[model samples]
Target: MIAGHGPLRRLKDGTAELHQEAELHVRILDADATLTDYRRYLAAMFGYHAPLEDALAGHEGLRRAGFDPARRRKSPLLVADLRALGEDPGALPPCVAVPPVTTLPRALGVAYVLEGATLGGRYILAKLPPQLAPLRGRATAFLAGYGAQTGACWRAFAAVVERVLVTPEAEAEAVAGARETFARLIDWLAAQTRAAGAALREAS
Candidate 1:
């Protein structure tokens, strides 16, 4: 199953155990990608790889602790294809912010960075459920943050995700850290979202 369109979900049942472990191994493989091209692809979609690997490791740790999320099988062909694409000399730039930039080239950059991927890779790894669904604070944060700082929306988005998914006791810390890291951008995005709302009402 698809996890709200961002990544593939693991299948449960007889396939769960093996498939779950397979994804972990694949994740580790990507985490250790030796190619510069792969690293660049990672940077484009996600802000950085180290944090992403951390997040993935966290989830794997959770699973080891007996969390029962669905399992996803790895495809060798898919991995080879990704490896090949990463190695391609003419591969596109990873990702670009949308709406704020809105340039055709930049928009295309976003698409290229996200294209042909079944999973969020590092991007979704740093995320919580709300970022991908239920339209939480992250969306609010993104429009509020924008260009003032790069990847602010993503950071707030990830934080809000952690808040909702993590226990309430930890929510404030998560939000605060996210706010600190992506401060300028998240503030701008929030402002933009508000402005857009006002514009929509004026048009109406």
Candidate 2:
């Protein structure tokens, strides 16, 4: 896991490019000032780089497969495209088409552990540890709300992923897990949007 400013640099190469793209949404969450400061506090307490290099290298591999790093630079939403399994950013594996909100947070929370492993190797060893569950829970809540908000504005999210991350490849297990999490959140938001639309129709 290479850490630094900007999108997954590892996608520049072929091997990890797709996986790199799929995880782009997490980048947006990381960029939030509040979240960044919070993560920094934890990372610092344990000694962490603002940006890790290994993860970036992994992202570069994905870029080589078809992800456009330049697009990711435009905005965080563009980073979402990197998560698609194929050219169609909207397409998703059956396993991830419907994600439960309850399970979403735990999955989203796993990102820190995954990122740490990718970046530090034995340097970091494991996750934030069970002791940090409070922080992790907070992150999960933030992610849930953020996803709902983002999904309500999904065209933007889709645009970002389609432009930069969509590629012709199998949605690997890791990619599948991320997609499942994202799909669940987006689907839930889409439902809420539709319900709101229905209420507006009744008033009209």
Candidate 3:
């Protein structure tokens, strides 16, 4: 149980390294990446988010914290992106398991990882090639999920997390959940990248 100044701060500080590693694996930052790169990235996102969102669905902790599971789902956007890119949703690989969220503190921790990605998506969206403009709204919906309301949505989530994680022990649990989620995402992305590379080699 690592203690910190605040729950959110602790989660961020604790997961900073894992966050950076995940960002490095994200395709949006690759300058030489092509449309194919984006497609694979979206597919990977779909694989990672679909299962996690399912687990979070109708979670009592989320509802009590004023977090609507429906609006927060990113898998649909990932699916739409895959479709817009001419990929079959059914062909995508299965998502990895997410950390269990039986408690409010743990739920908030997992939600934190998902919601926080929206903020980073803003940056990813901006760096997208000009040729990708047409897909911005449709294929890139996951990145631009909240649009201008992104900041507001994050603030609202933060408020709920703060309310739910009142004690030090609760905060530690939240941080642990967040860390586990981040690690899982990193592993999933690495596996996706490896699979993509193997496929490319087979094609060549």
Candidate 4:
């Protein structure tokens, strides 16, 4: 159901429950989500992605595996979206509890989560309600993600995983990275959301 075959399918299948649980945390796609809700979601995500990407930088294995980390950099896009929505990306706290990406296979595993998000981002953008519709071209670059290139980008990433992770050991490490990425993101968002809610209540 997660699509793809070989390592790609393995990664997706392994992390399926964690993926579903993350959606429960990311309420932006809900029918009642408001503009504020969307803003909060992007802000929380920036907090997660900024540090994760920073840690992921300089990992030569990603390049050797045929995927340039630079091409898939997501923090810049998140920053743009946050700026458009009137938030200062610089002031936001980045997640310190990031997944370990010290190895090539582990990095690819971490990447699997980030790259897969683009596919889900399209679905959210398409089904977004009118309340969340105004973000379209301006504040949704993070979600808009490669626009028409998302499919090809994901396919390319999947291929890289398949080709690079030919051994069972490498695939296992990738799965570990994927699971850890999901776990860290879910925890970070949960914490950020609680803090945001408390600040809002205090303001009122």
Best by lDDT: 4
List model 2 lDDT by residue over 84-184, tens digit each. 21122233122223322222222222122233223322222123444433444333322222333333333333333334433433213224444443344
lDDT of 3 by residue, 1-204 (tens): 122457778778978998998888887656677888788788888888888888888696688679987678988888878888899988887765667877888888898899989988988898887656557777888989788999898888887877889998898888889998998888888888899899889999
Worst 10 contiguous positions by lDDT, candidate 3: 1-10
Q: Provide C-alpha RMSD values for all models, in order.
A: 19.7, 18.4, 3.2, 1.5
Cα error of candidate 1 at position 171, Å = 1.8
**lDDT (Cα, tens digit) per residue for candidate 4, span 1-204:** 245578888898999999999999988878899888888889888888887787677788788778988778888999999998789999988888999888899999999999899989989888888888877988889988888988889878878887898999999999999999999999998998899889999999
Clashes of each: 19, 39, 0, 0
Pitting candidate 1 against candidate 2, the one with the higher TM-score is: 2
* Model 3 residue pairs with clashes: none
Ranking by TM-score: 4, 3, 2, 1
lDDT of each: 0.30, 0.31, 0.83, 0.87
For model 4 the TM-score comes to: 0.95
> Looking at model 3, how many pairs of residues clash?
0
How do the predictions measure up, each by TM-score?
0.23, 0.24, 0.92, 0.95
Candidate 2's TM-score reads 0.24
Candidate 1 TM-score over all chains jointly: 0.23
